[model samples]
Target: MPKSKVRKKTVYTPPSSDRTTTPVKLAGPTHPVYIAVMLGMMLIGLAWLVVNYLAGNSIPFMATLGPWNFLIGFSLIVIGLLMTMRWR
Candidate 1:
């Protein structure tokens, strides 16, 4: 029987580049007000939609705004959702 040959493996090295030595500042915890505002926006948006659906024809402002009510509700919800990304 013939003896099998062993294969040699090369060590892997990462490519080096010009990286800054300065340490990055870590972000602090999100402020309580920020969390409140974020939650408030989402809740307000949902409430707005609910109000529009429930009393759009009866409420003067909602009736006047008409389709714009949807925009306001969705915009608030979107703003709140965007804020979540920055939440700690």
Candidate 2:
């Protein structure tokens, strides 16, 4: 009887040059309190408009100013949103 020969398989190794050393960083604002305060101010302004409307009372100087408060409130909200997207 003849003896059979065995064969071994070759293993694969990754190169060290393909590895990454730096960590990934996120992009955005880090101050939550400022954003919260801006949002709160906007909400308060909106609430004032609603309350005055329901009470059938004309907002002070609204007739002359022409929706100034609403515009200011909306601007505040937009600023808050922008600040939230900024990096700290």
Candidate 3:
């Protein structure tokens, strides 16, 4: 009598986890808060630009700040933009 050979198959098993993949949480300002801050900065920059444009020398304080007045306004905008990057 010839004995029949039988093939054995192994089943694949997946890893067990309590939870599935989830999105990574970012640490920073919320959307609305970030937007508000950004907008405020933009408005301030705009106001500074306007004030300086209108009065080139009348603002005595500007004379003390020198070229920093322009820098301050531009810096605010830059900071806002940087902050926006952190927004989630």
TM-score of every prediction relative to native: 0.77, 0.43, 0.59
> Which candidate gets the maximum lDDT versus the true structure?
1
lDDT of each: 0.97, 0.63, 0.80
**Structure candidate 3, residue pairs in collision:** none
Total clashes in model 1, counting residue pairs 3 or more apart in sequence or in different chains? 0
Q: Which 10 successive residues of model 3 have the least lDDT summed?
A: 25-34
Off by over 4 Å in 2: 1-11, 18-20, 23-32, 51-57, 84-88
Ranking by TM-score: 1, 3, 2
lDDT: the better of candidates 1 and 3: 1
Task: Candidate 2: give the clashing pairs.
Answer: 29-86
Residue runs of model 3 more than 4 Å from their true location after superposition: 1-31
Per-residue lDDT for 1-88 in model 2, tens only? 9989888978887666966779878666657787577667667667755654564246556555555756765676666566655536
Off by over 4 Å in 1: 1-20
TM-score of 2: 0.43
**What TM-score does prediction 3 earn?**
0.59
